[model samples]
Every structure is written in C-alpha cells, then in structure tokens.
Target chain A: MNESEKTRRKTRWFMLGAFVVAGAAFALIAATSMSKNLVYYWTPVDLYRAGNKAYGATIRLGGMVTPGSIKKLGGTAVEFDVHDATQHVHVKTSSVPPQMFRANIGVVVEGTMLRDGYFQSSRLMVSHNNEYKAPAKGHPVDQKTLRKMMESTEGIKD
Target chain B: MKTAWIFVVLGVAFLVAGSYLGLFVAPAEEYMGNVQRIMYVHVPTAWNWMLAVLYAFGAAIAFLFTANAKWDARLEAGLEVSTLLAFLLCCQGSIWAKPTWGVWWDWDPRLTSVAVLLFASIGIIALRGFVDDPHRRAVWSAVATIIASVDLPIVYYSVKWWNSLHQQQSSPQTVSSQFHLPLRLNAFGVLFLMIGFIMLRTRVANMNRARETALPPMTEHAGEIA
Candidate 1:
C-alpha cells in the first residue's frame, strides 16, 4: 500500500479502538452504578430491611394493596396495607387514589414512614402488570366484574 | 423507488386491517377494560421503535468501517425514522399511563432511558444540519449514534435490572393467546411502515447529499461583472 493508504488504514483502526474502549467504559459504569441509582421505588421488603433508617425520610414504597384491608377514613383519605408476600406496610394516603385503584392491585405510594407506625403518603399511584386477559366464558364485561377482577390478584407476584 | 411505494401501500393496508381487529373485534381486557385497546398500537410502536434504533446503530457502524457515503445516507434515514417512532411511543405511553399508572409521566429507569436515547438521536440529527462538510458530518454523526445506542440494552433491561414502575415486556408466553392476533398483526404492520419510511428517507438523504457535493454554480459571470 502507498504511504497515504497506510495512514488512512491506521486512522480507521485507531477510530475503531477508541470506540471499543469508550463502549467498554460505558458498560462498566452502567453495570456498577445502575442498580444503586436507578431504583424507581422500594418494595415493602426493602422498607422492612431498612429498619430505623426507613423512618421520617420521604420515599416511594411499592407493593400490592392487601385484600380486605382497604379502609376509607373520610373523603379523599384512604388507608390500606401494602403487601409484598411476607412483609406488609400500612399506608395512609390523603391524596385521592386513581380510578383503577382497588384491593390486591399493585401500588406505589410516595410519603414518609411515621414514628407511630404506618406510611403517610401524599401521592398514590397504581402499577399494573403486563398480563391482559379477556373475560371468561359466560361472564359479562361490566363494572362489577371489572371491580371483582381488579380485586383478585391470582397468579401475580410482587 | 417504486418498490418503496409498494411497501408503503402494503404497510397502510396492514395497519388498517390490524387496527380494525384491535378496535372492534378484540375483547376488552378483564381489568383495564376498553382502555387496554391502546396496547395494540402502543406495544407495536415500541417494538418497532427499538428496531429503528438498531437499524441506525448498524448503519452507523457500517459507515464508519467502509467510509461509504451510501451507508451515511442510510444512517441519516434510520436516525430520523427512529426519532419519529420514539416520539410516537412516548405519546402513546403517556396516554396509557394516565388512567392506569395514575400519572402522565414517571422518572423510572425504563421510561428515562428511552427519553435519553430519543433526545440523543435528535441531537445527532441537529448536528448533521450544522456541519457543512459532508465527510466530517458523516463521521461525527456515526460516532455519536454508536455512543448513544449504548442505551438500547439499558432501555430493554431496565425493568428486569431496576425497580421500575413499568412492567416487564409482554411476549407470547406472557400475553394471552386470544390477544395475540391483533398484537402480531400490528407488530408486522408497524414493521412494514418503519421499513418503508426508512427506504424513502434514505433516498431523500442521498439526494440531499448529492446537492451538497455538487459543484457551486459557475461564478464566471459574476467575476466578469466585477
């Protein structure tokens, strides 16, 4: 190859090497710090594990709303137990829950754990699963059936 | 060029049929009810958006290695189409989020990573417009595209790797068989549309590049007047 062609080939290799190095560095950084920094919300188990550290700091706690635990304290204020398998946190929220909010549905509430016990949430949001099921045979699609379906958390895990 | 128009026609036909099935024929979801209909469009757009980004990444790599102007043209087409799909994906997600997630937007890892890549692609497209030198523009944009595309894996795996509000991806195994027909149809529809758009966009990019490389209009008359 001529001198110019040789130089051009060397430049291409250098560019390739730089890109590979940069890519590796990016992957390394993401792998190391992503888990720590990218958590959208903490589960009920995470709250239990935190112990005293979990108190007083505003945080988002996500889990299923326990069946039969939904209690309406008054207008726009509701209380429920957020459960994650073995662990559960009592969450009392003043904010109005979404239309889709119901028992045994996934929820993420943002607030602080009070000293007296129970999570005091200022914001409440529902998190739905990926599954989309049609109504079973002979069952009509109506408000009552939809409510019942929302209340049943069968085959779903936190 | 004619073949590109054929793909566009096929894409539109598929989309119409798929949408009819999704909107009228499919059953309402047990929990979400009719709102779940959005999934037929949203999921398909999301799946194709990822493919568009991948196309851009591949084109970028090919251009860098071969130093081929054709690849650069394809790269530009891929970037623009990816941006369009990403924008649509976000809008559809936002609409679905309101009733279900109780929020229009969230800073969760999955959503955030997608937004990051969308903005990165836009920035690269803007970079192409500012640079006058075709060679420098191609090389710089190609490198930028590859760099930005590192976020693709992160976007895909965000739900699995992090505590995201967004649920895990739904597949044939996860989704009910009854819902499969519309989903599959829409997926293919969007794929065809994306491919068609990319091909047409590539031609436009090629034409633009040609105009850029063409010699400046002869200035002999102006020189004589001077």
Candidate 2:
C-alpha cells in the first residue's frame, strides 16, 4: 500500500478505537443511572429500615393512594395515604388529583424532603397503566361527560 | 500562554462564585422550594452542551472554508469536549427530572432532540476520524454539523409545541426584577467555563494529530503497533 493508504488505515482504526471507548462509557453511564433510580427512589422497605431519610429529600414517591385514606378537607385540599405493601405515607396537597389516581391505584409524587419527614410534593402524577383499548367505532360520544369536561376547562390555562 | 492561564483562573473562580450565587443567594422557589436548586446544575449543563455544539459548528465551517488543519483540529476538539459535556448533561438532567418530573428520563422533544444531537454528532465525528483524507474529513463533518444544528431550534421549542410535563423555561426578569443582573452574570460565567474547556480539549486534539503526523511510516517499523 502507498503512504496515504497506510495513514488512512490508521485514521480509520483510531476512529474505531474511539467508538469502542465511547460505547463503553455510554453503557457504564446507563447502568449507573438505572441502578440509582432503583436504589435512590426509596421503597417503603428501604425507607423504614433507615428511618425515612427518603422523606425530606427531593424524591419521586410511588405507591397506591389508599382507598378510605383520601379525604377532602376544603376547596381543592385533599389528604390521603400512599401505601406500598409494607408501610404507608401521609400525603397533603391542594390540587386536582389526576384522573388515574383512583382508589388503591399507583401515584407518584415529586418534591422536597420536608423537615417533618414527609414527601411534600410539588408535582403529582397518577400512574397511567399500560393497558390497551380497542379502537372506538360506532359508539356515540357521551354528551354529559363532554359537557362536564368543557366546564372544567374554563379556568385551567394549561 | 498567559491568556490560557487567565481563562483557567477565571473558569475556576466563576464556577465557585456561580455556585455560591445559585445555591446560597437565590431564594428557594415558592413552589418547588430547595428542590428547585437543582436548576443551577441542570440549566448550566444544558447551556454548556448547546455552546459546545455551536463551537463544533464554527470550527467545522472554518475548516471547510479555510482548508486549514488547525480548524480541523479545532473541530475535533469541539466534538470531543461536547460529547463529554453532553454525557454530563444527561446525568445531571436525570437527577433534576426525578425531583420535578417524577422520572429519570422522558421521551419529549427537548430530550429526544438532545439525544439525537448527541448520537448524530458522535456519528459525524466518527465519520471524520474514519476518513484518512484530511480534506474529505473536514468537508463531511462540516456538512454534518450544519445539518445537526438545524435540529437545535426544534429541540428548544419541543416542550412548548407539545403538551409536555417540562415547564416553560422561566425568563430572567419573570421571577423578579432583581434576578436580571445576577442571571446574566451567571450566564457569562457559564460561557467562560465552556470556553476554557473547549480550549483545553482542542489542545489535546492538536497534540494527538501532531503525534500521528510525526510518526515514521508503518514499513519503517513493520512489526510494531502504535
């Protein structure tokens, strides 16, 4: 091979070497982050074992908002208990609970760790189940539900 | 040499000062409270990644037009540094997302585009390195950067165009009139930090290239692998 061919070969190999290096870096990073999500998103078991350091630190709490535990105090203020199988947590907030946050369903709360050791949520999401529905065909729209949803949209900019 | 040192010192000092300003001085946001402090890391990281991509684009264009090896070297440096910075950005953003969005990752516009940008840029740089002809490498990577950069605005507005959990980025003066000056200073500090990183990274690329050019032909030492 000529001198140019040889150099080109080296450049190609060098680039290959770089990809090998970067791919490994990306894999390592991905694994670490996934592990952290599992480890740091404290479960009821983990939190109880360590006296709930998980509370009061910003976290995403996921559990079932217990059935009878939900109470409407006044206006938008609703209080409920979020429960895993083992331990349960008290949640206080004043906003519309997501449509999916039905009795004994999964919910995730995001926010800071309060001094009182509660997951003082700044954001809440009711888990959307990975369920599939058949495509709507001839079913007529429910007029009453449509009217109710329209009425609710008057004040919400979002 | 003196200019390099000046940047290094400034980078360190501004990093320290900016940390203090964002962490200590800025009042806790009324809603998110101290969890909002994560913004200091997230915003800067995202900003730095953007700047790094810009640097790569500028270097690529320069190399294409000037046909100078130095511009090629600069383009290589920008890509390397930007890739690492993009890695950091993904990490820090994951941390921030958990506190705000209740998930480590989301498949939304800002995020989806950034991922595409990172992967596409990596591909461009890889293609550049694979081609032995210096001119070809420069031209191809330059074209790649321009194409990749076109997606940046699309990524920036992704959240707005879609009904996404990611909130609208707060304008500087929107929070308080007092935030304007401090935020600008903070942005300036981020710019300086990026400049320093890019310069350092580019020097490394130059050294690697020099090493490649200076080495004797393969036949001269036929058995040895560099």
lDDT of each: 0.83, 0.60
Worst 10 residues of 2 chain B by lDDT: B173-182
The sequence of per-residue lDDT tens digits that candidate 2 reaches over residues B28-86 is: 65434565555665667677778888888777656655556788788887887777777
Clashing pairs in 2: A56-A113, A56-A114, A57-A113
Q: What TM-score would every model get versus the actual structure?
A: 0.89, 0.57
Give the range where candidate 1 chain A is weakest over 10 consecutive residues by summed lDDT.
Answer: A148-157
Query: What digit string (tens of lDDT, one per residue) describes model 1 on residues A1-158?
Result: 87646644653664586479658967785876565765578888888889999999989888889889999999999999998767889999998888879887788899999998899999898887666778777754556644543433321244
- What fraction of correct interface contacts does each candidate retain? 0.56, 0.02
lDDT of 2: 0.60
TM-score of chain A of each: 0.74, 0.65
Q: Give RMSD to native, each candidate.
A: 4.8, 14.5
Docking class of 1: acceptable
Error of 2 at B4 (Å): 2.4
* Candidate 2 Cα deviation (angstroms), residue B209: 2.1
Error of 1 at B16 (Å): 0.6
